[model samples]
Target: MPNIQLIAPCLWFDDQAEEAAEFYTAIFSNSQIVNITRYGEAGHEMHGKPAGTVMTVAFELNGQPFIALNGGPAFKFNEAISFQVICQTQEEVDNYWEKLSAGGDKTAQQCGWLKDRYGVSWQIIPNILLEMLNDADTTKSQRTMTAMLQMKKIDISELLQASAE
Candidate 1:
């Protein structure tokens, strides 16, 4: 077999690393738990504690690698950087929006941006959004962008309608 190496996004949680990993894996298709390694006594320096205490977890979401670290609650997910998921259809957008918005604050911005319960920001955008943004007609593209700027989560149909006008 070919060398199977994966570099995943490692998330640090305040004692909720496992919970968050499970939550994320369940949300996306083609995803599953790969491994869960706890801290051990010998690896104190690696984890700042004895080994066997959930030092790292490896999981996959839609074939994307992700790791969760049970680090103490020193920092949190902020709006500065967010995961942008491009949906091929409006239904996909709606599904992610509904699921991610659970127990989280929802803000409707022009293009597409919403904050989840974990205080993590996400942008649920339609796949065609980029195409519309790069339309040959600058005016139309600007109008679409303007419409998107006014809302939080993007509605592809609405954006297309706005661009047509």
Candidate 2:
């Protein structure tokens, strides 16, 4: 037998790392908290305080593994890199988009691009997008791409319309 384990995504938060982890776990199915480790007494950096103050939390989301670290203010999530979620239907897109865009600024793009309250960027796109963009006709793909470039949250119906000559 071979020993194999899946790697998990690590996310750093200023102060709401735990809160964010909880929120995310609640949103996705087949997700739960694995562990919550706090700092130790005589902490190296957080000395003389409650050592274990949610140092780390392991959780799963829709079978995807993730780890949240309660690190001090050092780095913040920017719009440079974002997570892209492929949805099967319009309902899935709407569900995720609505929740993630609740307190964030929204820019209507062709495909889908949304920024959350934490300034983190996300893409809520449909799985069919790939097929539409990879159409045999180059012009169709180009049109779809153009449409996506103009909007923030991608609407599948619109993409289809744009791709259809």
Per-residue lDDT over 66-86 for candidate 1, one digit per residue giving the tens place of the 0 to 100 score:
888888778898777788888
lDDT of each structure? 0.80, 0.78
Candidate 1, RMSD to the unseen true structure: 2.3
The candidate scoring highest on lDDT is: 1
Candidate 2 residue lDDT tens string, 1-165: 875456777888766767887877776789898888887865565533356577788888887878888776788877667878889998999998888888777652234888776666778889988888888999999999998888767788888999986
Instruction: Write down the worst ten-residue block by lDDT for model 2.
Output: 43-52
TM-score of each: 0.88, 0.88
lDDT score, residue 147, model 1?
88
